[model samples]
Target: MSELLAPALSGAAAGLGVAMPMGAMSVLLLQEAVRERRPAVAAAAGIAAVDLGYAALATALGPWVAAHVTPAEAWIRLAASAILLTIATRGLLPTRPAPPPTNASPGAGASAGPATELGTEPGPSAGAGPGPGPGSGANAGPSAGPSAGAGAGAGRTFARYVGLTAVNPTTALYFAALTTAQGAALRAGAAGAAFVTGVALASLLWQQALVALGALAGSRISPAARTWTFRLGYGLVAAYAVKIAFPLP
Candidate 1:
């Protein structure tokens, strides 16, 4: 019992240590939450799932992974940087044209502006309530209809986060180092399972907290503020990409 408890606690700490850091991944996750387009819960689950997978792999093949992966760290970092840069660029670009001003004549077709340039679902209008009408931003168009909703499903968001988080070489290396140091404790029967469970739970909890924070922020801010927030978030992501591409001494 004590054996299991100790390893589990250690694993939880390790998971939090890795997940709590603010990186490109964190910025994107916050942006997702703020936009309230894709499901944040799904994104959180995806991140935790990737963390769990990496942690398990590291625990199982710590020595082998440490040997091979270390040699490819530079390449992996470069690839991750490239991917992050692409995402940031897409975010910075406008997905669709902005709608005509509110004072436009009745004959004018109001082009629905993208909620944010994240290339996901449309957002509700400023101060709009929960239904369909002129004010129902997301629900106002065929664009946000069944097909769009399906595309924005939890699975897609989950897969997106999994890919985003999995590309970080640091996650794999961090878990590998921990596993190498505590291989014995982490490997001992039920203790190993407990430890992995602890890691998953901690990672999930932290991610969910971020989602909640972003959602709260999304609710309070005006639409323009949300757009600026996304721009800032993506800008930070781009900065991270540059840093990863060429780390300072």
Candidate 2:
């Protein structure tokens, strides 16, 4: 138990080391959390899963990946940059308002006859309910709104974050480097299992904390403010894309 505990603790540290840094994925995660907590939670899980997967990959093929993959790091960075740029471009775009329903012509109702002629009045609108209030999930309409789409497609959100996390092969390299540095500590079966578990838990905890914080902030701000905040985050993401595209010497 003690041996496993040590490896687990070491893995936790490694996980935090990789995850605590603020980067493109982190910005998107926070923005998503502000938009919809449920999807954000899914996104967080996706991120953790990828982190653990990469760690496992590194453990299995550390030396080879590190050697062969280093030469193509620039290409990977460019790909990641392009993806971030695309996300920023979409986020910065203004959302178009839904079109209003057309009114019926006076003659259009003639076929149905007047309500008085039928001896019955029209009932209330079907599915009528109170509009969603600010800071509440009520506004998340069935067909539209952030929560509607995001909540409905939580699995998609998870997959998206998984892609986002996986795009940077450097994460695997990082774990590989750790494996080299740690030597036999990661080679043992029980210790390795503990380490992977630790990595998963640590990464998930930090990501979820970010989600909670973003949700709290979103609830406190007005809708306009939230919109502007998201725009600002996307702008930052675009800047990160530029940095990734052109790293300094």
Candidate 3:
């Protein structure tokens, strides 16, 4: 039992070490949440689900994968690195120019204009000019307003999240290596299982916490800030890819 306990602990530690880092998935989740709100949660959930599946596979078939999947590790890392670079570049690109401001202000240069005169029948009163109506202003339209479109936007966000995760070869390789490394401990039976379970649970717990924190922060950040955050996050993910591709060892 004591011997088994060590492996399980080791397995759990390995799981935490690999999963705890704020990698591409983490950055993607944060950006999605901040940009699309509710959809961000769905995207994060999907990523976590994938991680759980990978971890389980690593524990269950560590040996088989290690023996047969010789080129799998290399392939996955290359793919992940490519995707990260693309996403980072997209984020860094300049956004489309904002629409020019309209000159619809009441009586900007009109002589004796009733539109600007106070207490006039055709014009707005002193305090009531061409102000925005209820739920219809510069910040209250379909493009920026809160409406059903938000839900649709969430779906789009989820799709992007799926794309990012699916293309990440590094994640697959990481899992494979992890499982291979912990094989002996896992085969040791119940104790090994317990350790794997502990590690998996810890990873899930930490990732969920990050998702929640990201969602909360997203709610408060401005649109511009969110955009910059997305860029920075993707840039970091790309940096990680470079490191993985050219490790010191």
Instruction: Compare the candidates by TM-score and give the number of the best one.
Output: 1
**What's the TM-score of every candidate structure?**
0.81, 0.78, 0.61
Please write out the lDDT profile of model 3 over residues 55-134, one tens digit for every residue. Answer: 66667776665565555656666766777777666655533233433665656635646533442222111212121111
Any runs in candidate 1 off by more than 4 Å, and if so which? 95-106, 109-152, 247-249
Between candidates 1 and 3, which one is better according to lDDT?
1
Find the number of clashing residue pairs for candidate 3. Answer: 1
Q: Per-residue lDDT for 50-148 in model 2, tens only?
A: 999988877766788799778888888899999989888876764223243257565665554664244332211111111111223334445655655
User: Candidate 3, residue 236: CA error in Å?
Assistant: 2.7
Q: Candidate 3 vs. truth: CA RMSD?
A: 9.8
The lDDT per prediction is: 0.76, 0.76, 0.58
Alpha-carbon runs more than 4 Å astray in model 2: 95-152, 247-249
Ranking by lDDT: 2, 1, 3
Better of 2 and 3 by TM-score: 2
Clashing pairs in 2: none
